[model samples]
Target: MTILQVGALPVRKSRGGFEILLISSRETGRWVIPKGWPSKRLSDPDAAAREAKQEAGVTGKISRVPVGSYRYRKKTVEHIRVLTVTCYVLWVKKERKRWREQDQRTRVWFSQEDAVKKVREPGLKILIASLEVRPKS
Candidate 1:
């Protein structure tokens, strides 16, 4: 079975306009939106928020609808095509110190254009496009 993961498209407004927060994996150095595997019992949005807190150290409200989906191959999956993820919108409310202190994740903020371009997957690109990104207050 393909693993389903959830992510938060955390956005902030730069002087130029809206921008999304992205992180580079310490393991692979791949730039990706903040996310993690969904645990049983937690609702979808709850999972998104939890991922943001664990991965990015941000607390926020998540969107009701899933933004989009992506598929990737994992090492264990030789014959079965697995590794699917759903992107969700996370509206940042409170940021904690752990994010600034984290050494494993290389975090950066990007303008919508740069963000969309930097994202590795086409499905995630679609999620960024479909991002009903609200203006940061």
Candidate 2:
């Protein structure tokens, strides 16, 4: 069975353009977006927002609709499990100086093209590349 996860594609408008935020994985230190299993009390987008806050140290407005989904294999003690993560675009409002996983993960902002190159997952790269950024009014 595939496990479901929620993710936040944290973004902010820069002088040149929009930038995407990526965090290092706790175990492998690989670049990845903030993601976690679904929360019973929160909706998918809300859960994604929570993950972003804990992992990336950013809080923002999350889209009600999902941006996309990606499949990845997660390594566990017993075996590898396939997980499908639903992603939501978060228009970053605030970045905290400290967060829950601050010590475990490093967060970095990159241009859309750079973010696509930084992530390992093919699907995630496509999502980042295809994201449409509207000018902040």
Candidate 3:
């Protein structure tokens, strides 16, 4: 069975352009967006935002709908599990000095191109590369 997960592509406006936030995974320390299994009580977008706050230490306005989805395989002792992660854009408004997973992971902001290069997931790389941010009206 495929597992469903929610992801947050935390972004912020910068002088050059938009910057994407990425966090190191706890086990592998590889760069990844904030993502986790969905919470039964929270909406998908809200759950994505929650993961962002817990993992990346940022909060912002999150899109109600997912921009895209990606599938990945995760290995466990029993067997390999496939997880489908739906990603939402979060326009980061604030950053916290302390957060829940700060000790377990490191978060950093990277340029769009650089962020694409930092992540190892093919689908996630495509998502980041193809993200089009609209100007505020």
Candidate 4:
């Protein structure tokens, strides 16, 4: 297993509730949360935040219960099983138009419920369903 991470769950505020940010991968065009490998210098939340900025063009604070793990098949050299990805909820503050200009990225915001259904893997859906949306205190 390569243990490739699926990325972080960046979200935007919606009329009904918080919405999760999603991006289609450059390679597969598959919808996924913004994520990348853990950076040596950045903390997990910071790393996730960076990914959201780079991939989804959104900046926000990500905080929530440590969402559960999820597994998926990745095409990193070949079809490899990704062991797990730690998911988190991010509060989006800004959207950078420059990042969305990338031909590789197709960013969109969905209601958390919609996003939970949009993901391909069952574990990911479970992980999302497990997410505890913090009350805006």
Candidate 5:
């Protein structure tokens, strides 16, 4: 069975433009959005929001609907599994000084262009690119 995950693309509007929050992957040390397995009680978007809080120490307004979905291979103890992650856009409202995974990961804010270059997943890059064209609400 395919594993499902939810991710949050945390963004904030700035004078220069939009900025996105990225966290370093625990194993790979590569920049990525806050993501995790689906929660038993929370909706997908809510799960994504929870992940952002735990992983990136971010509090934000999350979109109810997913912006996109991406498939990737995740390594397990025995083998690899294809995982599908639903991505949600979160407009950051507050950032805490500490979080659950803060010691395990580094969180940084980057410009959309810089963030696109930092993320390794092609599908995620495309999602970030699309954000540039989306009309501000």
Candidate 6:
């Protein structure tokens, strides 16, 4: 069966306008949005919000509905599984001094254009690119 994941494209209003938060993958250290496997107890949007807090040290208002989806191959010990991630927009309200994965990952905030360039996944890149034109309110 295909694996399902939830993710948050965390955005916050900045002096310039808006910025997106990107975190490095623990294994590859590539730029990515905060994401993880779906939680059995939490709704998708809430799960995405939990991931954002754990992975990026930010808290915010999460959209009730996903803004988009992306597919990627994830390699496990024995096999590679296709992961379909549903992405929600998180309008950041607070940033913490530390987070759960702070030591295991690096998090940075970038402009939408730069974030699109930094992320490796093609589908995710397209999603970030779309934000330039249709920014979250």
**Candidate 1 lDDT over residue span 1-137, tens digit each:** 55877778887656776778888865687778777778788987789878777777787778888877787654543565567888777877787877642678877878787878887777777777666665756
Off by over 4 Å in 1: 76-81, 99-101
Residue-by-residue lDDT tens digits, candidate 4, 1-137: 35645367876656776777778877778778877787778777778778888877888777644466677766666656556677777777788878743567898887778888888889878877776675453
Worst 10 residues of 3 by lDDT: 128-137
What TM-score, over all chains together, does every model reach? 0.83, 0.96, 0.96, 0.84, 0.92, 0.92
Backbone collision tally, model 2: 0
lDDT of 5: 0.89
Better-scoring candidate (lDDT), 3 or 6: 3
| Candidate 2 lDDT tens digits, 1-137 | 77999999999998878999999999999899999989999999999999999999999899999989998888999999989999999999999999999999999999999999999988898889898878466
Model 6, residue pairs in steric clash: none
Candidate 4: minimum summed lDDT over ten consecutive residues — where?
Answer: 1-10
Indicate whether candidate 1 or candidate 4 has the larger TM-score: 4
| TM-score pick, better of 4 and 5 | 5
RMSD of each: 2.6, 0.9, 1.0, 2.3, 1.8, 1.9
lDDT accuracy of residue 111 in candidate 6: 90
- The list of candidate 5 runs beyond 4 A from truth reads 132-137
- lDDT string for model 6 (1-137, tens) is 97889999999877667899999999999999999978889999999999999999999899998889999888899989889999999998899998998999998999988999999999999998886423446
Which runs in model 3 stand beyond 4 Å of their true positions? Answer: 135-137
- Worst window of 10 by summed lDDT in candidate 6: 128-137
- Superposed by TM-score, candidate 2 places the C-alpha of residue 82 at a distance from the truth, in angstroms, of 0.8
Score each candidate by Cα lDDT. Answer: 0.76, 0.93, 0.94, 0.73, 0.89, 0.90
- Stronger candidate by TM-score (1 vs 2): 2
**Model 5 pairs whose backbones collide:** none
**Residue-level error in angstroms, candidate 1, position 2:** 2.8
